[model samples]
Target: METRELRYFVAVAEELHFGRAAQRLGMAQPPLSRAIQRLERRLGVTLFDRTNRTIALTEAGTVLLREGRAALDAVAAAERRTRRAVPGRPGLVLVTKAGATGELLSKLLDAYAAEPGAATVDVLLCQPGEQERLLRDGRADVALLHRPFDSTTGLEAEELYTEGQAAVLPAAHPLTDRPHLRTADVAALPGLPLPRWPGPGGTYPPGPGPEVRDHAQLLQLIALGRASAILPDSCRSHLDPGLAAVPVLDAAPVTTVIAWPPHSRSLPLAALIRIALRLGSEHGSAALVRGG
Candidate 1:
C-alpha cells in the first residue's frame, strides 16, 4: 500500500534475510518485518516463506517483487523529470572520486557559482560501486570515475585523460634511488610492503596486506618501511613528507572518465564537460612544456 512498505518488502525479497535487509536499510529488523507483514496483509498473499533456518520467495511474491521494482523506477524517473523542470534551480547532482576529479569539480563549481541561473551542484565523494548504484537509482545525475567501469549500459562516458600509476615507496628503499621503478622490480622485492589493491568503488579491497586510508597514512607506512602503494598520478599531489613516488614499470595507464545517465545532458552538465575538456587541454600543454 504505502511506498515505504513496498520498499521494505522489496528489500527483504531481494536479500532473503530480514536481518540483513534491515541492516542495509538502516532500520531494526522488527520494523522491517512489520512493514512486510502489512504489505502481505494488504495484498492477501504471502511474499515470503520464512523459517528459522531459511527465507525464500514464493511464486506470487516473485511476480510482485518484479512489478514493485518497475513501479519504483517509474516513480523515481518522474521525480527526476519534475525536479529538472523547476525554475531557477539546478536539478543535477554530480558524484566523483576523491582525488583529481574532486579537484577538477571544485574548479568547475567555482565557475558555476559565478554564473547567473546556475543549477545546484551536489558533489558527492562516492565509492566505485556507489556511482553505479546512484546512477541506476536516479539518485545521481553524473559521475566521474577512474576506468574501467564494470557496466556501460544506461550511461554515457567520455574519456578525460590518461593517468600514470606510480609506485609509492619508502625514502630509504632501494627503489627510491631510481627515477622510476618497474612493476616487475616491485613484485620481485623481498618483504616489500604493498598497499592493498583498491576495489571497483575505490575502497580498499577486502583481505589484507597493508591498508592506508589517506595520503598521510600511506606516507607513514612507507616511511616506516612497512609497505608500498601504487597510485595514479593525480594521487601524487596528495603525497606526504618522505615518500617517493616512482613510475611503475610497464603497467597500463589508468584513464579518468566522466559518466552520466544518458538522459542527463542538461545545459549545466554541458558546461561542466567543457570545463573538464579545457582543464585536460591545459594539463596537456603543461606536460608538453615540462618535457620540452
Candidate 2:
C-alpha cells in the first residue's frame, strides 16, 4: 500500500475512530472512509470492526499497523538521510542523553577524530527517552542508549559497557555516610521521592515526585533534598559538591549501547562505531574500578 494509505490506516487504528482520524489528518471523514475501504479491498482483509458508536482493530489490522509504522519510519529516514547528503558537507550526527554519557562521549569523539579521512561529527544532547525517537525518525544518525531505560526497538546496536547503579542524595542526608545502600533502603527514605522523568510523549507519569526533564535538574533537586535518584554509578564523577552517590547494591546494571538504523551503510558511522567499541572495551576495566 502507498504511504498515504498506511498513514491513514495507522491514524484510524490508533484513534479507533474514523472521524477523529480524519480530523487529525486535516480532512473530512468521507474520503478518509473511502481510502480505508479501498485499502481493505486491495489487501483482501478486514482492517477494522465498525459499529454505530465505535470501531476496533481486527487481528489483521493490528499486524498492518505494526509493520506500517516501521515502513513509514524507514521512508522518513531515507528522505532525511538523502536530504542531508549534500556534497562536501559529509558528517555524522550523534545523539545522547545530556549530562549522562560524560567522559565516555569525550573519549569516543577524540578517538574518532584521529582516524584518517574521518568525517566531522556533530553531537546532539537531548533529554532521556528522546534519543530513540530522534534516531528512528532520522533526526539523528546514531545514538548512545542505555538498556532497561531506553528502548532500542527497530535499530542496530552494539553493547559498549555495563555499570552498576547508585543512589544520588543530598550530601548531608543521613544515608550518605553508608558505604552502600540497597534499592529498598533508598526507596524507603522519607520525603525524598524519586524524580519522575517525562516519558516519550513528554508527559510525566502519575507520582508524588517532582517532574524532571534531565539529569542536571534532577541533581539540583537532589541537592536541595527535594528528590533522590537511582542512576548508573558513572554519575559519581559528575555529582555536584552538595550531592553524593552511594552504590545501590541491588539495582540493575545499566548497559550502554551505540545504536543506529539497521539499514544504514554510512562509512563514517561505521568508523565511529568501531572507535566507540574500542574505547568501551579499553575503558571497561576502568569503569569497573570506579564502580567498585
Candidate 3:
C-alpha cells in the first residue's frame, strides 16, 4: 500500500473517527473516507467495524495500524537521513533524556574523544520518552535508554548495566527517616502522588499529581513536597540537598542500554558503541567487586 494510504489508515485507526482523522490529515472528510474505503477494497479486508454510532478496529485493522506506523516511521527516517547525508555533514547526534545518565554520558564522551580519530558528538538532551522517536526519525544517531521505562522497539541496543530503583522524596519528609522503602510504601504515602511524565504522543496519563516535563522539573516538585518519583539509583548522585532518595526494594530494576538504528553503518558510530559497551562492562564488574 502507498505511504499516503497507510498514513490515512493510521490516523483513522488512532483517532477512531473519520472526521477527526481527516481534520488531522488536513483533508476533506469525504475524500478521506473514500481513500480508506478504496484501501479496504484493494486489501480484501474490513479494516474497521463501523456502525451508526461508533467505529472500532477489526483484528486486521489493529495489525495494520501497528505495522503502518512502523512503515511510516521508516520512510520518514530514510528521508531525513538522506537529506543529512550530503557532503560535510560529519559527526553524530546522541540523544537521551535531559538530566539523566549524567556520569556515564560524560565518561563516554571523554573516552570516545580520546580515541585517535573520533568524530564530533552532538548531544541532544530531550524530555522523557523522546529518545526513541528522535532515533527513529533520524534526528539522532544514538541514544542511552532505560528499559521498562523507555521502549527500545525496532532499535539495535547493547545492555549497559542494570540498577535498582530508589524513591525520591523531600528531605524532610517522614519517609526519609527509613533506611529503605518498598514500592508500596512509596505509593501509599499521603498527599504526595507520583508525577506523570508525557508518553510518546506528548500527552500525560490520567493522574492526580502534577505533570512533569523533565528530571529537573520532577526533582523540583519532589523538593517542594508536591510529588515523588521512583527512578534508577544512579540518580542519587545528582539529588540536591533538599531531596533524598531511599532504595525502593520492590520496584523493577532499570537496565541502561545504548541504542541505535539496526541499519547504521557509520564507522565512528560503531567505535562509539564499542566504547559504551566496554565502559558498561567495566562498570558492572566494579559493582560486582564492591558487592562482593
Candidate 4:
C-alpha cells in the first residue's frame, strides 16, 4: 500500500530472489521477505511462488510488478516536477540514442526552437536501451526511439521515420561481396557474431562477440573484424571506407518514433511533439504510428 512496500515488491519480483533484491535495496533478506509477505497478505493475493531453493512470480505478482512500476514512476514524476517548477527556470529533457538519426534530430530541434514559447531543450545522448529508463524514471521528458528494436512499453509514441536495415561488416569480409543479405545470412557469419547490447534489465544476453553499448562500440568491433551488426540503413551515412553496409532484405524495417510518457502535461513538451510530427509528415517515408 505504501511506496516502501511497492518498492520492495518490485525489487523482489524483478530479481526473483530475496537475498539479491535485499542486497540491491541496501537491506537484509528477512525484512525484505517480510515486507513482501505483508504486502501479499494485505492485498489477499499470492504474489510469489517460493521454496527453499527457488522464488518465482505468480500471475498475480506479475500484474503487481507492472502496476507498481507505473505507480513508482508517477511518484518520481511528481517529485521531479515539483523541484523543476522554479520561477525563472523552465526546461525540457529530450533523450535519444547517440549517432542515431542525426539529420532528423537537427531539423527537429531547429523547428521546435522556432516556435514562440519553446523551452530550452537539453538534448541527452545515451547508450542503447537507456531511453526507456530515462523517460520512466523522470530523468527525461521525451525520447526519439526506434521501435520494433527499442521497447516503447509504458510510453506514447509518434512515428518519425521508417527504413530498412543493413548488415555492417569489414570491407574485406566475404559477405561484403554479396549484393544483399538475408537476416539469417548476417546472423550465421562464421567468424563474426552479432555484438550484444545490454537488455532493458542491463544484462547482456548470451553471446560470443563483444558486448557493445552504442553504435560507436559496435562499429569499432566490426572494423577490427571482431563482430557484425544489422543496423538501420540510416547508419550507412555514418559509416566510413573501413566498413561496408549491405542491405538485408529480410531484416525488419526500423521505425523511429518520438516517445513520451502518456501522463506528460508540460506545454513545452506538447509543442515539441507537434513540431516533430510536422517534420515526420513532410519528410518521413512511412506513416506516423500514434499510440494505441
Candidate 5:
C-alpha cells in the first residue's frame, strides 16, 4: 500500500523470519510484525504461512515479493535520473540567432561538452522576436540575441561584442577596387541590388531591391552583379571567388548579447553564460581582425 510497507514486506519475505527482518530494518519486532499485518490487510490476502516453529511464503507472498522488488527498482531509477538533472550538473538550452551567432554558439557548446558535469545543451536557432516569448514560456534556458532587446524585465542580457556591417559585392564590381565603401557609396551605385528584408513588416530603405530570403541568395545576386547587400562582418569570411566584402562606413555596430531568464541564475547556468560570453567576445574580435 505504501513504499515503507513494501520495504518491510520485502525484508520479511527475504529473511523468512520476523525477528531477523526487524533487525535488518533497524526496528522493533512488534512494529515490523504489525506493519506486515497491515500490508496483508490492505491487499486482502494472506502473505505468510506461520506456525509456532516455522514461517514460509503463501502463493500471494511469492507474487508480492516479485512485484515489490520491481516497484522499488523503478523508484530508484527515477530518483537517479532526477538527481542528474539538478542544477550544477550538465544540461542546458541555448536559443540563438541564425547566422554568425549560431556558429559561435556551436563552438562554445562543444567546449562545454568536454567539461566535467557539463550540461547537454539543446541549441535552438531562433529569430529575434521569439527570444522573449521563449524565455517567458520556459522553452529555453538562455538566448543569444542581437542587441536592443524589446523587453528587459524578465531577462538579463550581457553585451558580448559589437559586429559591424559590410557590403557584399561582385569581385569585379567597380566598388570592389576601393578598400572599403560607405552606405552612401553603395546607395549611389547604379542598379545596386539588395536583399529583401525578411522580418515581420520588413522593408528595406528605398532603393533598387531583389526579394531574397537568405544570405546565400544575397551572395548569389552579388556574384551576378545583380545587386549588393549589407551584412555583419562575420558574413564577409564566407566570400567566394565571385564575391567580395567592403567595409561599411558610419554604420551602427550590431551588438550580440547573451541573455537568460532572470530567475535561472543557478551555478551551472551562470557558468555556461560565462563560457558563452568569453567565447563570443573572442570570436567577434577574431572576425573583426580577419575581415579587416
Candidate 6:
C-alpha cells in the first residue's frame, strides 16, 4: 500500500531471509519480520512460508515480486523524470548502443534540432543491452534500439530503418572475396569464432570466442585474426581499412527503432520522434510500433 512497505517486502522477498534483508535495509530482524507479518495480514494472504531455519515465497509472493518490481521501477522513473524537469533547461535524453547508430543518429539530431520547441537532446552512448535498462529507469527519455538485439517488452517503438547484416573479418580472409555469405559460411571459418558479447548482466555466453565490449574491440580482434563478428550492414562505413565486410544474405535485417516508455507524453519527445520517422522514412521501412 505504501512505498516503504513495498520496499521492505521486495528486500525480504529477494533475500528470503529476514536477518539478511534487515542487514541490507539497515534495520533489525524482529521489526522486519513483524513488518512482513503485518503486510501479509493486511493483504489477507501469506506472502512467505517461514521456519526457524529457512523461508520461501508462496505462489502469491512470487507474483507480488514480479509486479512489485514493476511498480517500484515506475516509481523510480517518476521521481527521476520529475527531478530532471527543472525549469529553464528542458531537455531530452536519448541513449543508443555506442558505435551502432552512426549516420542515422546524425541525421535524426540534425532534423530534430530544426523543429520548433525542440528540447536540447543529450545523447548517451552505452554498451550493448544497456539502452533498455537506461530508458526503463528514466535515465534516458528515448533510445535508438536495434530489433532482434534489444528487447522492447514494455516500451513503444517506431522503426526508422532496416538493413541486412554483414560478416566482418580480416581483409585477407578468404571469405572477403565473396560477394555474399551464408550463415554456414561465416560459422565454419577456421579458428575465427564469433566474438561473444556480454549480456545485460555483463556475463558472456559460453563460447570459444573472445569477449568483446564494443565494435572497436571486435575490430581489433578481427585485425589480429582472433575473432569475427556479424553486425548490421550500416556498420560497414565505420569499419577499419584492415577489415572487410561480406553481406550475410541469410541473416535477418536489423531494424533501428526509436523507443520510449509507454507512458511518455512529452511534446518534445513526440516532435523528435516524428522528425526521426519522417527523415528515416526515405531510407527504409517506416513501420511503427505494433499495438504501441
Candidate 5 residue lDDT tens string, 78-182: 454356467555566677655546567767788777768776778776544666556555566777777543455546888878887888888888777887778
Write down the TM-score for model 3: 0.86
lDDT of 2 by residue, 1-292 (tens): 8999999999999999988899999999999999999999999999999999999999999999999999998899889989999888889999999998889999999989999999999999999988889998898999999999888887899999998899999999989999999999988889999888887578889989999998989999999999999999889889889999998989999999999988788899999999999888877888767546
Estimate, for each residue in 41-160, the C-alpha lDDT of model 6 and write its tens digit: 999999999888989999999999998998999999989999999888889999999898788899889988888778899999988899889999999999999999888988999888
Per-residue lDDT over 234-266 for candidate 1, one digit per residue giving the tens place of the 0 to 100 score: 666666667778888676777777777676548
Off by over 4 Å in 2: 290-292
The candidate maximizing lDDT is 2
For model 1, the local distance difference test gives 0.73
Task: Please give the range of 10 consecutive residues that has the lowest summed lDDT in model 2.
Answer: 283-292
Candidate 5 residue-wise lDDT at 142: 78
lDDT by residue (1-292, candidate 4, tens digit) is 9999999999999898888999999999998888887888899999999888999999999999999998998899868867876766779889999989887889989998888977999999999888778887878889999989788876898887788889999989987888899989888898889988888678988978788888888898899999999998878878978999998998889988999988677889899998898887765543233211
Ranking by TM-score: 6, 2, 3, 4, 1, 5
Residue pairs in clash, model 5:
90-118, 90-119, 91-119, 91-120, 193-227
Candidate number that wins on TM-score, 1 or 5? 1
TM-score of decoy 4: 0.81
Give, for candidate 5, the lowest lDDT window spanning 10 residues: 198-207
TM-scores of the candidates in the order shown: 0.69, 0.93, 0.86, 0.81, 0.59, 0.93
Pick the winner on TM-score between candidates 1 and 2. 2
Error of 3 at 73 (Å): 1.3
- Model 5 / residue 245 / CA error / Å: 0.7
The per-model lDDT (C-alpha) reads 0.73, 0.92, 0.91, 0.87, 0.75, 0.89
Model 4 regions lying over 4 Å from their true place: 8-41, 45-66, 285-292
